[model samples]
Target: MEAFEVIQPGPLTTIQDLGRYGYQQYGVPPSGALDDYAFRTSNLLVGNEEGAASLEITLFGCQLRVLQDTTVAVTGADLAAALNGSPIPGWETVPVRRGDVLSFPRLKSGCRAYLSVVGGINVPMVMGSRATYTKAGIGGLEGRALRKGDILRAAAARPVTGRARVPTAHLPAYDDQVELRVILGPQDDCFTEDGIHTFLQSDYTISIQADRMGYRLEGPRIPHRAKADIISDGIPLGAVQVPGDGRPIVLLADRQTTGGYTKIATVISVDIPDLAQTKPGDRVRFRQVSGDEAVTALREYERKIQTVKNSSA
Candidate 1:
């Protein structure tokens, strides 16, 4: 069986797929790749299924030794990657042979990167997904991040004819500033009109407290109509919740199943990748959009993904 041995587990490396489903009722978080576009497209570049498991490398990258011959692709944030002392480009498929050492030395831009091999990471699935929820220690390899000396196996490697590359236009730009379109929330009425205006107009800086769970932005405090508390409700990905401190925390893939904070808005699906790629100091601004517009934007993104998949096929 083909496998990889972790030489250096940089920062936080973990296996992730589309995420665990139908289990949030049990307080389980859908701990999938933060950057979905990178995760999905990287798998495609390596000729793997859309939901194939890949390594979500955070902040920094890791060093791995190929135990068997296979092909791999690196996408999302460009952590300066090199293969056995030679510089190698990311965002494209690269062939590897047994004993080749892949290392990510620097994090040039973006916060996370996806490393996809020809065969998906063959980790045991929990609740129908292989995503790693570190908090609960469920799914993925022992439900935790990759560690040094850990050996990872792939399901099966498929034949490849040539290198596959994602076009520049299809790639995401990890600029210092990102604007995410949001839909006014299920609890938007809890906030005053000025609060909504502040949320849409003011700029927020991603705080160091930001993590897979949620991004705690530091900016103007958004005033609530009465209190910031809410009868604990189900939380969704990209939920913009404000607590007593009035600071907005945008929940992410690993967010708690429910939150007591009032959710003023929800980021549209199309802007998730951009939000996910932001680092601690990145600037974020929100724009309001109608529910209908949000649906149209999502459809457009899906259409692009399908087009890429079809072309590659």
Candidate 2:
């Protein structure tokens, strides 16, 4: 196995894959890459499988030196990555030779970036996943963020002819303002008619108090008709919980297995990748859709991804 030693772990960096599903019964949240689409795309660009473990760098990424030749691709946020002091473009796979130093600058657009290598990061798997769940303190570099002088092993080197290239037309355009599609939730009736209208029409700004657990939005306070505290129930990804204070919190990958707050709506899975890229103060809107429509949209997105993979093959 080849490895890369971390010189400096800028901000936050962790190893992640598609995520750990089927363990929610054990009270474990499916912790994984925040932007699954970007993560998968990066892995594919490096000729890795869709679920290969990759580095999920937040805000700014780390400085690392390769101990062996490798193919790598960066996706998601434009973190101004550089190799050996030379600029590296996002969405394109590149060859990184031994002793080459890679650095990620401050984010220019999105908040996080995914760095995928040819054979994926080689780390001990817990609960059948390489994803780091910082809350429970499991997986990835001893269940925590990568640090200075840490050497991360990569999976055994496979014969690589050259770097895989991603067509420019296949890349996703980063947008600051995003309109997320929502499905009227299990607790939609708990909100007042006016509150629902306000939620649909108002533009909410992403609050600074955000993490993998949830993205708190700052906007009109939506008052619930019933002030009663509900019993805790299973909360899925993208569940928009409205606490008594009225601010909406959109749950994400590291969200709790269950929540007691009233949910106004649930953002569809197809739009979550866009939501994952939003930074503090980014404006966001929500549009309600039927459950069937939401499912259709997700299927369409998946189909497009398959089409791209087939075309490349």
Which candidate has the top score in TM-score? Answer: 1
**lDDT tens digits by residue: candidate 1, 53-90:** 99999877599999998889998998888899898887
131: Cα error in model 1, Å: 0.6
Candidate 1 wrongly placed segments (more than 4 Å): none
lDDT of each residue in 1-313, candidate 2, tens digit only: 7568999898889999988888988889998999988888888777778899999999885799988887888998888999988899887778889999999966788878999887899999898998999999887779998999999888885645655555666676778799999998889899999999999999999999889989999999998998725898999999999999999999999999987889989999989989999988898999999989988998987876675455431
Per-residue lDDT, model 2, residue 206, is: 95
Tell me the whole-model lDDT of each prediction, alpha carbons only. Answer: 0.90, 0.87
Q: Point out the worst 10-residue segment of candidate 1 by lDDT.
A: 304-313
**Steric collisions counted per model:** 0, 0
What's the CA error at residue 7 for candidate 2, in Å? 1.1
Q: What is the Cα root-mean-square deviation between model 2 and the actual structure?
A: 1.4
